[model samples]
Target: MHQTSSRLLRMTDDERPFTRSYIWPQYALLFAYPHRTSLFISDPNNSCDFKDLFSTLMVSLPLTPHRVRFRMIDFTFTSDEAITNLGSLKFSQSNRMPDPKDSSRVVTTTTTTTFSMAKEMARSVCQKFFEAKFIESVESKIDFQNKNSVWQLTPKGIHILERFCSRNGIQSAHVKAVIDSSRNPRQLVILERDIDTDKLHHDEQTVEIIFRRFVGATVNESLSADSDSIHEFSRSDVGVRMIKHKPSNARPYEHVFTGKATVDWLMDCCTMVDRREGLEIGQLFLDLRLITPVDARAPGNDTKFVPTKQAQYYVTVHGQQIAGWTEFDDSPIPADPNSGKSREGAARDSNSNRTNVIIRNPSWRLLYREFLKDTMCEENLSFYLEVQEFRAQYTAAVSITGDHKIETIRETLAAAYGLYNAFLAPGSPNELNIDHALRTQLATRMTRAVGDDTAMMQSLVEVALLFEKAQNSIFKLMSSDSVPKFIKHPKYGPQLRGLDAAAAAAYVANSNMSSSRSS
Candidate 1:
């Protein structure tokens, strides 16, 4: 390889960048450091530092390496002018910046102004958390919209956020702070005329969230108080409640149901949306008691069947399967039996299939007599699917939509899944003919300097995920706009979205109280 700049250092060791794996402990290193916020971007500004850090990870390598690259079919990571410069980012410190009214950028149609400023602030804080986690090579993009609310992170930025959230867990205020940190009216864009309640189904939980945002909860307030929610509060100051690192919305509940239908129903139940966002509630109350047919069937299953009148859905992530529900609402069975088409139709209808991840696992069962301790309602979720089982069962169940954007997304997921497929098959990225090509392409001059074969190879998967995560972080920055972006159109891909955590949950179910694994 040839080089040109004074800051760039050439490497002598051919094996320096070479690594057997880069996945483990990646999250650990990120959380340990929290002040630096430049590792998320790929900027020329941090060239020298990136070169040094590449040399560090190479010295220590994992004993057992597991790697696979899944291909997400029908996913669209590709972009034309419309979505161009959306995902793929490459910024130079130019003296000139785009004017919002410039010919290149157009707000042809006015977007509904429900965008959340707190969510935007949260993205920035998350970006900082990620940057702090990195050792070096941090490039920061503080202002996304020096033009608008779009913020970019350095590769350093990527390293910090990716691991911090993974290790420390996502805080509600962290996202809010991201929005609050960058509150410049001249630069920020929030269009708030009115929201359309008709677009959302009436949901009590949904209504609660709306009111919670408009007039958020606090430790001082009663858990059952909706009357306090009726009085108007400043949307900006309303969500604030302090945390170890930042102040956020008053109360942050783990939302079990992120579904639009469910949330709309919850909103209409409380009559909050119309009052809060200047929206009008329509005749959605009729369907409040009804449970949709699809809700009856499992995500990867056909032939919807109600779980039994005595059945109620319970959800929990891996290791916490017996914990509690993020939501307590019943899965309303839809009255219209033919309201939707067959299982095949549901998968293709992006709108319908997109949010099935919200559903609880039918396989979820409680170990009532033994480990069950808490009053918190518990249901079991496990993730044990055979390739043949997944394919044979969900083949007809999975949508074969060819939407390029969605396809691109699916393709990316496929890369990770390929590794998963290979893992059970005892396969590797090479066996699947997949390498860290996605990540290697963005090493820039600095990563290329100290990055060796192993590091480069490990970085391949890390970088690919890093990019997708960068996209996730950018959207996840704000609670209102960003949260919906990730939960709405997940980049972890759809299959991951609907993760009952069962497959993983089962693995860690009884082991929750077990001693931690020894190094």
Candidate 2:
């Protein structure tokens, strides 16, 4: 939205058309992609800007650290064999002496230094040829484990040895020294401090600086441990260590609509956002209380908790592992296109690419009533998870049903999708703004009022019970004093006792009426 300038032809920076026909929306939409966005239409009157939406997603982006280090060589070959051709390592050219009786005989001297160099050269050559698999590169180091004979890296890595340092409001070069030592550590996997810390600003340690120091030159290319090198890392001000990194992460809102936290860390960092053309961002907020179903036993037979997918995530963002992203994509650093299809395709590709498939351990979700707080959560959470449930009901409502309770589920799935931001969140992305709640409610009410009546019980018994509990909620708006007063004429009350069933029927009828009025 633009405020018409009093000066007609006057132009401000935001509205200036960079391209011949393009105009930048003043407020860019920050979308929390992977969100069910069709919900925005629940209240058709509530218009939001198309530009304010944004999706910050965790992409498990691949990384290929420029430097690499190995602690224990896993090959069956001996260390000697590992360095066989690097230099004439096994050959020694030292002077040999005969017995005293043969002292007069000539003494011969052999050259060992040249042999050692030759062997070293051979080792380098062999590594390039056969171990090329280990030479994978990345934008950053990756973390992984192995049973034996294998080393792995992940996008989940930290930079080492060549850290940047700053102190007293001024950045220093010393941090670089720390980084250098680590990059070429003498020992493949030495403790962080053991490498070198001599010249660091003796007293200060900020997380940013610490992060760099810890991640810097740790690779085993060349242990750059030198007194001069130690002197290179700069120090920091006095109170640095106490500072903790404020992860620029949003909660994983995949559960904005349903699910016990399948992945806890992810949900807490979820953020909600939106973006569209021609409008200013009107709303963006965390549902701090986005609802999902609780753990329950099987209806009759099972005792162990089996969490329902209701009120759980309606959508999810899939990504590759950080360490293997590059091996999968052949690129050390990955880019985010914010295209839901692309990211999902990448994930499917990578998952299918695995030669060994491993199923992760499963954990249980505790009873929601016992562990969670929202009183009406059960009422608000999703109950019907399948589209078939609505088969005989409203077609529009049935279109969005899913087998899995996800971050979102609604009637406009075909036109809506998730977006992912690469930098902020690692696994889950922020979401776009959509009036999911309002729209869902409207759909629920509409379906009950006009479509199939039986499915209403499957969907909204909880709501009916709530009304029963707080009878005042039902009568409060019906009082004669309220506008559009309930004309309680003698004819209106005939056989009109507010039985639960009758009330349910009336609500359905009214809901249909309202939906039609709006349309």
Candidate 3:
């Protein structure tokens, strides 16, 4: 068992269970409670009555080399208040007493506990906490008592507290500030020391230079013929398009480029060696909001930048304005009279061009799957879809209530293990190309047998978290590596263009018919 788990299991049988599900809610409540700071007492070893400790002030003072002193009263009071306010334990009077004036009437009043009883209960709870290694005294005392010595949360306690706050969505700024200020700075030094300062600076400079060069490059309208050949679109021809705003019923044009065009420019001009590197750079640009998907109705809506010929993006207006680049003229483009194409025909062409069949249309998924099969990387897509299905199942199982909850969780666990064996386990056929550390962690979790409901739920949560990380890694692999090759494939590229052409012809025919009838 992990050290934390072993510590949690150390509680006495008479004490309340120290399981995660049981303790986290209580921890959150106590951590979030407000406590008054007390002035430093002159006598450090002052003793007090157990009941009086609840009302005693808490001191925040540096007692040791790097450790800070926190009063026991603050923790006791917070624990008392948290336990008293709990819905299950709230003080209530079940028995009614006869009224003084009228024997026929009865009065109902809330039951109040004696100070001694409340004090004892809080002390017992705090003692359990100390025994479980949640908190320790600055003086290194083994037992918890009502003394002047200060106390602080142990690493285990902080870990649980952090997890509880995250799980419960408790965004208490005051709580965070307190935790941050109280935490030992030595723990963070190792993480800070691992960062390569010079390399990080170089990366930042390179990204900034790339962004400047990319935005300043000339852009133009995409032609119908350019869709057939990825290389046919000139650097200057990869420009802006006037797309109609469906909600506002207004035409707005923005400087845009196809994903293929962007990658090509990065590889050819920016010295990017391979398609994956170029796609990663493009994704970085999308993440920073320097460029945005044209299909997205608003900025910051989409994070995944598809590196395909069909995918389009715009240089964000804010970014362009900041860089002092001139905006595209808002005026409508004059129709090409020589081509003999009507306004309706042009609209149909734009509609057909906007189709991203691979993602939007279910029918095209099979075609993409077949293409992946030919490339021997069909496992990537299969794993992605399986993880998505497992996520849906896990979500539904979590919503289950009552007696069926345990059984539902068991079923979810089965599904989780099935996913793990198929894609993540070592020596398993079709094992995924995930990080070695993640696979090893999954292996460790999967090998352990869960005995009880608490253990089962804990295992399930850990597995789900690890699976999510693996899913993300696989998704990036497919997006940056496989998807680009699939898009540029000779067989698939022509088929995609053919579908677009056929759709365009059908749209123009219907549009002309509609126009004739309206006239």
Candidate 4:
């Protein structure tokens, strides 16, 4: 089912069914039909208007099998005959009868103005449908004025329309029959279900707790006589063993546990029911970058945690810090008297000059965030991280190519709204200092109702771009204004310098130990 939906959504321009020239005539005819007595003016920019127009088209336009030809080949396609009669309709005053009392003149004038406006409005709506891949040209012609080219609903179009009818309780038996016959047989068993947002949130929290507990439970230890080797042993008697892993490229030795042991720990301690569930939770940890494979370049590399003894992984430094495990080697480095700077001062100077380096390292980022908090400008860093997370989700949402694409997009939009309310909205608790014009643009786009999949996707894209701009603004503000102050702070600066010196000392000690082991 997802395969089919993904293929339809990814249709290329050359594979598209409709030509640019065919859309206006068909929609103009539908809009200008004299029998459309109930037609009313609506805002072209509003999503509700688009929905109403689509519903009206579905009801008013004739749907039947029509003979079409492309590349000297005949095909039976479903479409309406509105395009055939587009030339017969006229929106000018000449089409109306003369009225001496001027009462008839008023009616003619109104009809002429309304019909012309409606035609253009319909054309605009039709273009949106084409852009959304809901309609395609029957003849696939290139000419802008090709009246011979009719429009037909693509499979994706048919699916969305069916959903629209079902959602609104609008029954069209013929349309249902067409959908049933056209739908892929394999997708019949896959019923569409509403996403359980609360469950998703709960699961995320649960996984976070599990990850923290797992990292806390596993502590660095010396499991062998070799001083260069280190292993992380579980605090509990689960007997999980993490062996020392040293890469062939002379990377430092790190503790790594087999995937099977990790899954076992998740099931035995984390209350996971089965191996499948344990493996899934483990994979979630991998996705969050809490853990990584020791042999990433191995054959058949997968991001997912494979529940096998052959697969070895290690907890990341960021994961360890977040889990409340501060295992920094506090060994002191001797001062260089000849350099005219103390060891601590040299470390501070090196780190203070590199704001990018500070943010990239989890330890430095934590300290920097603390420094910002003391300065009463922590919101800048908070907003920056929030936008970073939103950007990741936006990327994932747009790249989705499955039946759940709509659901993923909806979730991303919800996150975007939350982000705006928290940081971008006026008078928001963490209101960010951003350009007023950009803020207004976001407000306008977010305030509008999203009526359909097309509107929702479009709004999501627009919001993502605006959020990116706001993120960039905040990042620049922090880099130019706050970062320098943080690096030179009287208290946090020394602490950061200490951390850098400890890390350097630890690296040198590890290198010495490795050399002695080799000897």
In order, candidate lDDTs are 0.24, 0.21, 0.46, 0.49
- Select the stronger candidate by TM-score from 3 and 4: 4
TM-score per prediction, in order, is 0.20, 0.13, 0.29, 0.32
Q: Which regions of candidate 3 deviate over 4 angstroms?
A: 1-360, 497-519
Residue pairs that clash (backbone atoms under 3 angstroms), model 3: 220-239
- Which pairs of residues have clashing backbones in candidate 4? 17-137, 18-136, 18-137
The all-Cα superposition gives candidate 3 an RMSD in Å to the true structure of 25.5
Please give the distance, in angstroms, between residue 276's alpha carbon in candidate 1 and its true position after superposition: 12
Q: Higher-TM-score candidate among 2 and 3?
A: 3
Instruction: Report model 1's TM-score to 2 decimal places.
Output: 0.20
Alpha carbon lDDT at 507, candidate 4: 42
Best by TM-score: 4
Q: How close is candidate 3 to the true structure, as a TM-score?
A: 0.29
Top-lDDT structure, candidate number: 4
Which scores better on TM-score, 1 or 2?
1
lDDT of 2 by residue, 107-160 (tens): 332322111235544444333322211211221212211111222211111121
Question: Which parts of model 1 are misplaced by more than 4 Å?
Answer: 1-201, 209-214, 219-393, 397-519
Angstrom error of the Cα, residue 492, model 4: value is 1.1
- Native-referenced Cα lDDT, model 4: 0.49
**Total clashing residue pairs per candidate?**
106, 111, 1, 3
State each model's C-alpha RMSD to the native.
Answer: 23.8, 33.2, 25.5, 22.5
C-alpha lDDT (0 to 100) for residue 155 of candidate 3: 41
